[model samples]
Target: MTSDDSRSRRIGRRSYLRGSLVGLGTLSVTGVAVADESGNQCPAEEPDESEEREETEESNETEDQEEIEEQYETVVDVVEAGADPEGNESITPVLREVVGDDTLLEFPEGRYYMDEQLRVTGFENVGFVGRNATLVPATYHEFDGPQYRLFRLGTSDVPGRDLRFEGFEVDQTADETGIRVISVEVEDGLVVRNVTVRGVHDSGTWGPGLFNVTEPEGEGIVARFRAEDGAIHADETPNAGNMWRGATGIVVNPDHRGTLVFEDCSLGGFPDNGLYASNETGRVGVDGGRFQNSTTASVRLSGTTGRIRDATVVVDDDPHDSNGQHAIRLDGGDHELENVTVDVPQPNGDAIRIMNGVDSAAISSSELTVGDRPNSGIRIDPTAGATTLEDVAIDIDGSANAVRILGEDAEPVVLEDVRITGDATGTRNRHAIFCERSGCQFVGLDVEQVGGDSRRGLELRGSEYVVADSEFVTTHTPIVVNGGDDVTIEDTVGRSAGDGYSLRITSDSGAVGLAGNEFPDGVRDDR
Candidate 1:
């Protein structure tokens, strides 16, 4: 057995002992019941079922770890295999000759230089681990043809299984420097972690990383992979004629067919979109990352079913040759955004846009804060499917609608426990909830709009709507039913601080049902 296998076994034994001890302690505490002095029995202790379950779970986890460690039977140190460690010579030739299947390639405490891409394909159970190692790539002019990437692990047609690449720093701070550090296409069980790119990408090449899982049952994770300096525009680089808009931080394209998770990654202001994983057929998850100041969007995701949870997207600075910047954009999927925080202090577009053709979406327990610009906080496009906004809060400092729902023929939307508070100061009429869709339900809504006289609270323009248990406080009319059929406002409160009516119903409106609602400034029924 190899030293790595021995070490893994020892670690697994320790983990198992630790878990057993923890389970025993829990059992000792929960298996006994105690009473107070007054003879009132404490809550009856159930059987110690959780202790057994915990022990089983820990044991299974240890087994999985040991299995992974044992697969790398052969270990090769690249420096020992006729490769230079001082960054004076290219390691690409040695890597091409020494890389093999079921091997662990180690780089120990050195700087490796490469002027060409190192391509590997159709290998199983391969790993590249680094210890205090740095990789320096050739500048744009000196790199070989198709100067896009440093390492191409696998291709879609010839994918490797069970790959791991981690623990290295990429130094691209030299003049005219840029390269895609690694592009990995795997069939199953891929892990890429702790690879930090340290500099701005100025070579007008591809982005720092691209990853994909090419099989239906495959799973992959890219964690703590940071490129915080980001990239520049292509026109400013020596390779300007070959590329467009410079590089993006990371990309996952449409050929991906399995589940991929990006966890705790940080990306800076790239010229194009940051973490653009749209147009994929499988599931993609962005969990706990910070993506900031990309041109089109900081985090744009689309797939069959996916989510963006506990992530932060900020657009504090405008990109060069600035275009619209959406903090988070979701397209063509059944997705959810939970516990997300989007702060666009220099907003150029909507904070969160659910684009057309989305099957279904939900935004829950998220906070969106937009600056003093004329962009909407959340915009649901006209052709999107059903959506739900629950436990969400929007804070706007400009004349933007808190929630703009467009599509008159779209599916029903539900907004429950949502809060909108901010100043609407523009000349145009800005409503907190601007709904043009039919068959929508608004429940437990708290909306407050201040500043201009055109700042209304809720404008419902479609048919078959219900507004229940909502409170609206605004400068203009709080509730306006301009043209809608079978609209009901029950158990709600509408208050206007200005001279406008608290509730207004235009003459062209259809049948309206009002039950147990309070309009402090009175209602104007022109019908």
Candidate 2:
């Protein structure tokens, strides 16, 4: 029989039983066959192969001495050259020769196209590995519903296990609706390394990396929307359209239970976001990735237990075009950013910002340099949660305030070792640091501006400060501690050209503790 015919015959039985005899039923007696007299037919018997095997082979001792192997889904092996695999020159025939409980399908250095969505189900360790093999979309414009996943785990009827899709590219051109998913369910670890996906949307058709799977009927995929479970790639799926986050690039959202890893990958040009993990309760760890020119933020991880380290996020280059954007923005949830460099080189932009219920983003040994624009370098914009800016340098090279901490009527935000500086080009009333309506602790702060448009040096309004041994210097007033209670400006110093006050304390009944303070106007009380 042909390979297709054999596959047709194997899966033809609706409810065939092939499990070991030990699992037949709970046996009260081990060897006794307590017959069921309910007119049920006998189990399928094995064909007579002992006589033919004895006629051909040597002895049972020789056969018994051979390698002992268990029966499993055979892996259909195939190789690839530069050209297509026809009947002779192609590996498709050999792939067809695999025949159900078959051999492995292997490809070495070439592009392949599958007319059917390669279903790798009902078998343990049924693997498809490619040594730099690219699998292009192979179908007409109308042949796309759920049959284009480069390799899948579960299907309409069959559940999969111990399967792997290693180092393969599911490329799309024209009607490349990406990797369509009836339900991509895997049993073993789904490892995707050194793979690239492009053109998930070709005009009318669009596709995502993967989707959740439900059961065969309609009662299985109900839990697909639960982001609290883990990543968005785990499900017992029946059909398509379940938690399909519109991701076109190397996206991994496996339903909160799937551990999707992207190690040393380059992500670019997806209309929403790159390396996106929204509402996934699992930890989305990203290491050594370059996210540039993404339609949204370079990395948008909204999950509570997500992390981003050693990454570069550049929003735009031109000064006139940021489209009113800010690079490296994290909103909502508890997270960490270690060794992150957010470089916003455009106008009307911010380098790093944490706002709207964002908390516990400890900045350690990282640089946030906003280009010469009329804005603050770094901002914690009015969130009730805790945002600690520790060891972060906000160097804005424009006439704008270097860093604006706008937590008006919000929670306390902390800033430590943050060197905020403006360009030495224009000089005026722009600020190097502006904190308004917020409560923050500034420790080890170095604020400098040479020939700039920084107004009033460091301005504060309704914002209490715990200033200790802080140095603020400009061509204007050194520090403005006004409109707050319990404000302390101790061990502060500033230099002015002429007509400039050393430190201006505007709040009435406010006591200024003067110790080791150097300024042009010496206390006006004539100390």
Candidate 3:
């Protein structure tokens, strides 16, 4: 049978079995049947490999969901526990009296106003479930916490474990200055879901995000949430002339360890970094999120083994166009970024800045487009260890370099199947890729029009380099090795515009070998 017909037959069989198993009470015990009641054994049925795999995965997922749901019991309603949802009274004592082990505090659809910071500490398996309920913080003068937080989950010294805070919105717009919405310092088993914080944060010494996972231990997840500061953009009313108040959307500090997952979350129009996961001893996973209009880096993650998958960072038309804003900053970790998209419309922005001390990084299937004069699409800083950028496309619209590797190191930095385009008219960009570190290999590179103001397609200034199977179409020069030793340029084809040479080597380069390179006028040692 054809593959399609076989797939259909398998699907139909699985569907029929699923429907039958729902009503077969006796057979449901084992999820599979064997014998008949007539004393005759039935033939053993061969299992469909794909069908069995999918079913096993789904069963495990359902078991996890069921286990989580069975842990917490809805015990008390905040309104019934002397909480005045009409925005008048203090619910601190009432909320304290209602919470217990494995208790879920249910807040109905109403706006709860708090003059003082609503604090919860040292509680296990305690949760907050709200249905369209909002916690509105009073003005900065009326609020009580010296920390200026709307909700404090756990203290710094004393941590709470097995906590869940979900389905609530915190309004910090009334106090225009920076104010943290939720500050969580938990030990283990924490979940923060579907929480929204609205306002421009401008109060704290170092601006805090809407949700701050300060010192989490073990496993925790923050999903389906939004933390936005509307005024940090171009058209909104500035906080005070320049309204960027160093606001972060979601931040995890360095004290956190173990696994912390952020899924389906969003952070927009913040002054500082958005969605920061920086822990020296932890592993962070950011899956499917959008970080936009950040003044500094959009997402900065530094962990033992960090991952950012299916994430998008946008720095388009930000009003306070700062020079040091990096769309995504990977610092101090062996991180893997997959299927990430970065769009930088501002001039002085870097799409991806991999800082020093990172053990390793792998970025695959990612696209970066920078407008105006952004710094670089991807920058591998000094002291960074082995890095691999594969199947990545970069487009620079202005005078910025597409990829830049700085400082000197002997760790292998590999670029495979990478396409970089500098598509500007009057002010063409610099080199499409600039390398200054040793031990690097470039394979399958497609470069176009990256030489403006006497730049090159690829500029190398370090030793032990390999450029093979690469195509370059540039304005001024194609490849230039200013200060490098043991450089090999093989299997490369390039065309330089105007009267500029295809390959130019300065006096500082040493021991350069050019073999199998299809250039117009061979290699010119300008030394």
Candidate 4:
């Protein structure tokens, strides 16, 4: 196995839902039992040494017989079933005749040309294994299923379950193909491992994607996968009947109601998105992956509950003023992002984006570095529900604020132990943290502006907030309150390099209260 494949397997068992379910309360509709008092959502109690030894002995005895049966169980080979290995003719007819339920179909090492979309339906426990094989699909003009794809795993009349595809390379570089690599709809256990797609797609329909899962009802795993330069035509003018017009790499459709796990997958230079899971009722868990270079968000997820842990998202290219193109976009409620790093070096790139309908989301132990742009390090839009950001670090070298909260619907957002640093001296009203929403709280926040024309460290606009036990270092104003009701500032320390009030309240509102704030005697707010 490749090194990446090994890493995928090693992290495969550590699911985000395991042991961390309690943090999500009752968000999960599947009714998986709440974690025990021991707090193990996914218990990992291994067998003892004696039990291991007995199992090993039994495995040793049956290994040879199992291997014999496995070899004998090979139901069909495409080449033996009238498929041309020299890429001369279509293989769909021959493949359809031999594929069946509980079948182990094999494709030997050869270049097979496909003129039509290969589809299977009403089957269970079907395995497609390829050994050093490559599938070269037909060009757009000659390809069958113009609105379809290269491989379709199920149909509405006969939705397959427990389908596996492994060890193959789909070469779309030879022609201007717009076909999706593999599309599947499985009720349970959809596994795609050790697969790579090399090419660009120009589809007028659903743009070409490496793997597309329409409706996954159970656990879906995609590991050791790579998609290089597979872009989408979704953003082009007047999209046709192609449902996935903007799909790039792996897309789990919004109807999914299961767990989608992506491990050790690498995607580069995709346009729309990479590794997206968009079902509000489903769960997406990404571990050990790299996503970069997209016109839209690299990793966009909208699920009921999910986690993006130990992952890296970087925007190394010039964003070219692509608005709303974030490194990571999390629209799912009750989701968690831990130990993830996002680097947005583009001009208008945003490191992390949180949008509407997101409630009880948590971002902890993560670092986001944003470049010179008009976007914030993290943006919470209107319609955002209760959220928490703890133990997070943000570094910005831009005209944008480190954190920006907008609209009235963003309420009850908490920031605890968050550190934000700005590289600019002072930008007018550009703050380390800016809030336009009500009922927000900042606890244990540390903000510093080292250089540039940036002014305030924290600014509140028409919002009710409580600032407690926070520290601010700025060149000018540290905190500003502009027309907010029931605002409380307590137990905070401020250090300024310029002669400005540490606390600036623009409105003479009776709802603003201050207590236990420390500043220089000459520069303090004594009102």
Best by lDDT: 1
For model 3 the TM-score comes to 0.80
How well does candidate 2 match the true structure, expressed as C-alpha RMSD?
16.1
- Which residue pairs of candidate 3 clash? 177-202, 178-201, 178-202, 178-203
For model 1 the local lDDT of residue 218 reads 60
The sequence of per-residue lDDT tens digits that candidate 4 reaches over residues 1-527 is: 36564344223222222222222222243343333445455433344534533543343233332332242234577788888878888887888788886676778899888888778877776777787888888776777664458778886445677676778887878646555777877766566767787776555445444333345335666766777565655555234454443556777776576666676677775556766776767677776578887756788888777777768998877422345568888876667787899988764556888888777578889999887766788888787777789999998877777888888755678899999885744554367888878889999999887565645688877556899999998877788776666888899987776766787776444367778989662343334
Candidate 2 contains a number of clashing pairs equal to 38
Q: 1 or 2, which is superior by lDDT?
A: 1
lDDT of 2 by residue, 1-527 (tens): 47665454333211111111111111111121212234244543333334422321232112210111111234333653233533123233344445243333556667665554444567533445565676665543434335434345564356554333445554554343344422354432232333455543332222334532222110011111111101111121121244342333434353443223333455554444455555433334454466654434556665444455566766654311225445555665565666677776664455665667675555666777766666456666676366677777766676766666776777766777777665633343356777775567777778776654434567677545677667766666667766555566667666653455777777342544556666755433221
Ordered list by lDDT, greatest first? 1, 3, 4, 2
The whole-model lDDT of each prediction reads 0.82, 0.48, 0.69, 0.69
Model 3, position 476, has a per-residue lDDT of 73
- Per-residue alpha-carbon lDDT of candidate 1 for residues 1-527, written as tens digits (9 for 90 to 100): 77676556434433433332222222122222223345354543343545544553464334343353455667788999987899999999999887887787888899999999999999977878777899999998999867899999999899887777878999999977789999999886677878999999999999999999888656677878999998899899887877768798999888787777787789998888899886558777776789999888889888776778778999889866676989988878788887899999889889999999688988999999988888899999999999999999999887878899999999989999999887765356468888999999999999888778568898989999999999998888899998887999999999987887888999999988999999889989999
Cα RMSD (Å) between model 1 and the true structure? Answer: 8.6
Prediction 3 global C-alpha lDDT: 0.69
Q: Which ten-residue region of model 3 has the weakest summed lDDT?
A: 20-29
Q: Write the per-residue lDDT of candidate 3 for residues 1-527, one digit (tens) a residue.
A: 36575445334323322322221121111222333434253543445534543543353234333343345554677898889887677666677678776677888888787766667787666777776888776665566666356667887576676666778887777644445667787776666777787776544323443333344224566766777553353223223333345456677887676566676678776666777776776767776678887666778888777778778888875745555778899888788887899988774567898888798889999999888674678888878888999999988877767888887854878999999876642254457788888889999999886444665688889999999999988877788898888999899998887556788889977988888989985567866
TM-score of each: 0.88, 0.65, 0.80, 0.81
Please state the error at residue 147 of candidate 2 in Å.
Answer: 9.1
